[model samples]
Target chain A: MKWESVSDFFAMGGYGLYVWGSYLVAVLCVIGEIIAIRIRRRTLYKHLGLRKRSILRGEK
Target chain B: MTINWFKYASPASFYFLAGRMIPYFSIAAIIFLIVGLYIAFFSAPTDFQQGEAYRIIFIHVPAAWMSMFLYVVMAFWAGIGLAFNTRLSSMVASAIAPTGAMFTFLALWTGAWWGKPMWGTWWVWDARLTSELILFFLYIGFMSLQAAIDDPRRADKAGAIIALVGVVNIPIIYFSVQWWNTLHQGASVSLIQSPKMATAMLSGMLIMALAVWMYSIVMILIRARLIILERERHTAWVSELKEGVLE
Candidate 1:
C-alpha cells in the first residue's frame, strides 16, 4: 500500500527477490502436496476397485 | 461411558474418524489463514527498522514452527508404531513425512528470504539453518527408503528406525541459536515466556501457526485415509464401504 505503484510492491524495498521467492516456494509446496494427495487417492481407488473385481470373480 | 481412544488408533476406525475430521480442519485452516494474513498485513505495525521486510515473519515463523512440530509428530507416530506394532500408527507416520518435508522446505526458503534483508545474506551456514537442512534430508531419506522396500511391513520398520534416529536432530535444531553465536535471531516467542513482539505481531504469528497446524492435520488425515484404503482393500469393511459408495 505504501508503494507508489504495483512495481514497488513487487520490489519490496529491494528485498523483493528474497521475500517473494520465499512466499512463492511456500505456495508451490502447498500446491504440490494437494496434487500429490489427489494422485495418490486416485491410485488407491483404482487398486481397490481392481482388487474388489478380482475377488468377485473368484480370481484371487 | 469409557471412550476408547485407543480404538481410534486402529486403521479402520482412524479412517472414518479422519474422514469426519478433514472437512472441519480444512475449514478451520482456511479461516485462520485468512484472518492471520489480514491481521499481519493490516493490523501489525511495520517494524521500526525492517519496514515491509518484517511482514515476511508472519509466514516464515509459522512455517518454521510447523516444520519442527510435524517432524516430532511423525517421529512420535513412528515410535508408537514401532513399540506397539499398530498398523494405523505406521500409516500415520508414512502419511506425515511428505507434508513435514514440504514444511521444512518452506521454513528454510522463508528463512533465507528473511535473512537477506535483515542479515545481509541470502543464505548462511548458521546452526539453525544447517540443522533445518538436515531435517529436510531426513524426510526425503525416510520417504525414499519406504518406497524402495517391497514389503509394507518391512518399509514401516525401516522408516520407523530412520525417523527415530532423525529425532535426535530436532533438539539440536531447536537449541542451535542458543548454543552458538549465529546470525539468526533468537526466538521471539517461547512457551515459557511472553513473546517479545508486539501484541498484534504475536497475534498474527499465533494465527498463522494455528492455520499451519490445521492444514497439517487435514492433509495427514486425507493421506491416512488413502493409506487405509490401500492397506485394507481386501478386508470386509473396505469391500462393504466400496459397495455402499458405488450404490
Candidate 2:
C-alpha cells in the first residue's frame, strides 16, 4: 500500500534482501518445528508397533 | 465454576486434551502470523531514524523475547517436576527444550543480520549479546545433558538442575543493557515505563509476540504428547492410543 508498484514493495526501499531473508528464515524455522514433531510421532508409532509385533510373535 | 485440573494432569488425559488443543492453537497461530506480518510490513510506518531497515525489528524483537520467555517457562516446568515428581511435568519440560533452542538460534541469527546493518558488525562480545549467547549455550546444554543419560528419571533430574541454575543468566540477560554500557539498545517496551516505539510498531510487535507464543504452545503440546506415548507405551492407555492410531 505504501509503494507505487509491486516491485517497489518487494524491494523494501533497497533493504529487500535483508528484510525478506530474515522473514524467510524465521518462517522456515517455524514450519520446520511442525515437520519435526510430525516425523517424531510417525517414527515412534512405527517403532512401538514393531516392538509389540515382535513380542507377540515370540510368545506364539 | 468448577475446575477439574487433576483430570488433565495425568498423561492419559493430557494426551487427549492436548490433541484437542492443537487445532485451535495451530489455527490461531496461523491467523496471528498473517495479521501481524501484514501490519508489520505494510501498515507500519517506516522509522524516521532507521528507515526501512528498521522493519527487521518486527521479527527480531519477538524472536528474542520468545527465546528468553521460553527458557523461563521450560525452567518452571523442570522445577515443578523436580519439586512434585510429576511425570507429565518432566515431559513438558523435555518438550520445551528443543523449541526453546530453536527460538534462541533464530534470535541470534536474526540479531546478527540486524546488527550487520545497524551496528556495522555481525556480532560483538558485549554484555547483552554475550549473555544471550550464554542463554543459547544453556539451552543446548540442557538438551545434550538429558539425551546423554540413559535413565529417563535421572535425565529429568539432571536437566532440571541445569535449567534452574541457568535461570540466573536470564535476569542477567534482561538487565544487561542497564547494568552495563552495551552496544545493544535497552528494551523499548517495559512495564515500569512507556514504550519508546511508535504505536503501530508496538502493536505489530505485540501481535507477533502473541503469535509466537501460540506457536510455542502448539509445539510443546505436540511434542509432549509424543513423549507421553513413547514413555507410556507399555501401559494399557498407550496401547489404546496406539490402537486408535492404527485403526
Kindly list the per-residue Cα lDDT of model 1 for residues B40-117, writing each as its tens digit: 866887788897788888888898888888999999998889898988899999999989999888888888778877
Please state the error at residue B203 of candidate 1 in Å.
0.6
Task: Give one digit per residue, the lDDT tens place, for model 1 in A1-60.
Answer: 445788876786776777678777878889999999888876776766554433321111
What C-alpha lDDT, on a 0 to 100 scale, does residue B50 get in candidate 1? Answer: 90
Real contacts recovered, all predictions:
0.48, 0.45
Estimate, for each residue in B1-247, the C-alpha lDDT of model 2 and write its tens digit.
9988688789888887787788899999989999999999888998887778888888888889999999999999999999999989999999999999898888888888878878899999999899999999999999999999998889999999999999999999999999999999999799999888889999999999999999999999889888987788899866654455422
Task: Give lDDT: candidate 2, residue B58.
Answer: 85
In candidate 2, stretches whose alpha carbon ends up further than 4 angstroms from where it belongs are: A50-60, B1-4, B245-247
Q: Which stretches of candidate 1 lie over 4 Å from their true place?
A: A1-11, A50-60, B245-247
CAPRI-wise, candidate 1 is acceptable
